[model samples]
Target: MKKVALLVIVTFSVITTYGSIKSYNNLNISSGTMIAILIMIISLSIFLTLIIDRKTLKKRYIEKENELKHLNTELEETNIELESSYKKIEKLNSSILKILELSSFFSAPKLMERDFEKKVLDLALEIIEPAENGAIYLFDENNNAKMVFAKGYDYEKINELNLKKNDLIIPEKAEIIKDIHKINKNKMSPKKFAAFIKLGGNLKETLITPISFNNELFGIITLDIENNSPLKNYEDYHTKIMDYFGKTFAGFLKMLNFIKQEGKFHKDIALTLVKTLEYYDNYTRGHSERVANWASLIAEKMNLDKRKIEQIYWAGILHDIGKIFVPQSILNKAGKLSPEEFEKIKLHPTKGEELLKKVDGMEEISKIIRHHHERYDGKGYPDGLRGKNIPIESRILAVVDSFDAMISERPYKRSLTKDEAIYQLKRMTMKQFDGEVVRTFIDIIDNFNIK
Candidate 1:
């Protein structure tokens, strides 16, 4: 509008100047009139230049505004991508932590075969989501499916179903069974398949995977979602995770079997030493076994872990192993031992430790054996370890070993009755034995006949 108005004013001024020049020529106009006309023209030219400059500045401002909007959009997109990446990193960290937790499960000590299988099933369930039920099945020599571990269902009922390897229509890889009844009856046993359908009303989706390594199937792990429709609840990664767990568990089982075989051999060697002690002194017959049984019972009553209880039991078996070095005359002596003979008896704990430390994996057992005679008040020999300084396994053994010896007949002394043995145990608390261990030992005596 300003440019158009300036153009109009300039046009009118030009026409007016033309008319004024004519008048000046005809009438001989004054010099002031010419100067006034020149001033008007100069003023219009200045106004037009200012308007053009303002238009250029306005255009630049609009361009700059558009550039800023584009930059803001790009920044917003980058923020979204960054937020997504951060979430992925957090999820990856969680998965890694779960994997580390699962990796450490097998290393835990003293789990029986069934306990180990149950642990595997539990850890698998933890990693996968929305799974309320799981079971682990092993293939027996007859190619029969034996339910070793079951969760979220009637365990006894499932085990009684008598599932066979040939009865299953599973592929080599892990799979999600969306509908159990949809499976072709011609490919699977109708009798067993119908049994699963009738066994649990809540069984909906089943993720069945083989526990295999090198294409050799050792077992099967099955996870279930209860009381839900057969929707696409699992992804490809779920099956992959199941497969990984199956293979890992298979490897663990193989290693466990090998370890069990090795453990049997080591046990046989330990038993041989026990038999040697028995042959040396007829009075000590069955003494070591009885002590082991009592120590294990006391350990169980104390709520010790499986690993520690096993160690205590082995320590009990080998507690008298060092006494093999003692002279037969000193062992069966009906009379009281001389001071020199007593010193020889005290050396047995140290001797037991020295002998067993040479064997692999017996390091912990040796430590327990070496300190079993150490009294709570430091009055006992072999280390004089006082108060809580003794290993817990040794403290447990101290109570059990003394009680068994008190109740068992020996050449040097008559066996005390059960009540008398219990009295002696209570009397010696905090002095000759750990009070907690003594109490734990006596509390469990009613479960077994001491003699």
Candidate 2:
């Protein structure tokens, strides 16, 4: 920019000098030497102006370049900071997925506080990294929240505090906190919840985040740090980071609620289906529920995961769904079944599997239902999957199904005693059923005092 300015100024100076010399020569004056000196003076003046303009332009260009460089440096720093923040968010997202997976355990009819606390705290700590103290409080039906788990705190003293339901008592000052309750009541803008922390008789900062699910506040996750600084202090992007964490936690809780509702819905539908099947066939009255209970017990004895146990329970409840398609005469026949009638009965497992496969998310349970009739020696119907090729769940279901059949009253035979049922199971081990699964079944029956 400076070089262009200098060139323009030099060209103008040369043109002006030439014009002045030409005018002096055309005047033909006696004072030729004076006119020549006058031209020299004019040329010098133009040269000085050009030099001054060049200096000014150089100064401006240097200032502009320096300003642009500073801006580029700041932009680069910002981009790096944004990239780091994004990576942190991604890590937080992965942690939330783990929390969701853990929360699936609570989808059962009963929520075990011990298990819930252990899993919740583990995930919470990972999300809120660098926190020295934390606690997870659960909301009870009476609208009160109680601490179920605490880390890095004196349990006895904290328990003595007895934080009430929706109660916001600051431990250090005994001042009743107010924002949390207002937020719960108002449903307006976000409210900040804070408390004073006391460490060695000195006041510090304490913060609590309220956990909410489905528009109902569950409990607070409390944190205490050493200094009196605001919770929003320490990290420059603390507000944004905390907000992201809170939203993620909320999403996880929502997903947990959804899963729980889904599981219950499925259970209800399965039970209803069992009841319907019972209504249709007197011989199989109460058979589905019994099978479900036995299957669940067998699954537990086999040390199956909660998900598998749940699948087994549902499969047991709906195992006879295919019986709905069978004719009433054949199902209630009082004599030995003809080969054709028996073949029809054998199709129930496959029919049930086909019906359940239409519903989404029931693939595992449906597969178990379909394969429950399979023999360990690869002689079963639908699919003759040999040992180990069958799903372990299906194997467990096979034991429970046969046991229920033996012990339940039928048209052609009477029910067996509990001991007789166990004896029969032991008699068929390996040849007709998985041996280890049968043992597990026996153990469960013994331990639970099942009659």
Among the numbered candidates, top TM-score falls to: 1
Model 2, C-alpha of 426: deviation from truth (Å) = 3.8
Model 1, range 196-279, lDDT digits (tens) per residue? Answer: 767655566778888887777888888888756455376566776777777777877777777788788879999999888899
Question: Compared to the true structure, candidate 1 yields what TM-score?
Answer: 0.74
Best by lDDT: 1
Lowest lDDT block of 10, candidate 1: 179-188
Computed on alpha carbons, the lDDT of every model, listed in order, comes to: 0.80, 0.68
Q: Each candidate's TM vs. the true structure? A: 0.74, 0.62
lDDT, model 1: 0.80
After the best TM-score superposition of candidate 1, give how far the Cα of residue 249 lies from its true spot, in angstroms.
3.3
Candidate 1, pairs of clashing residues: none
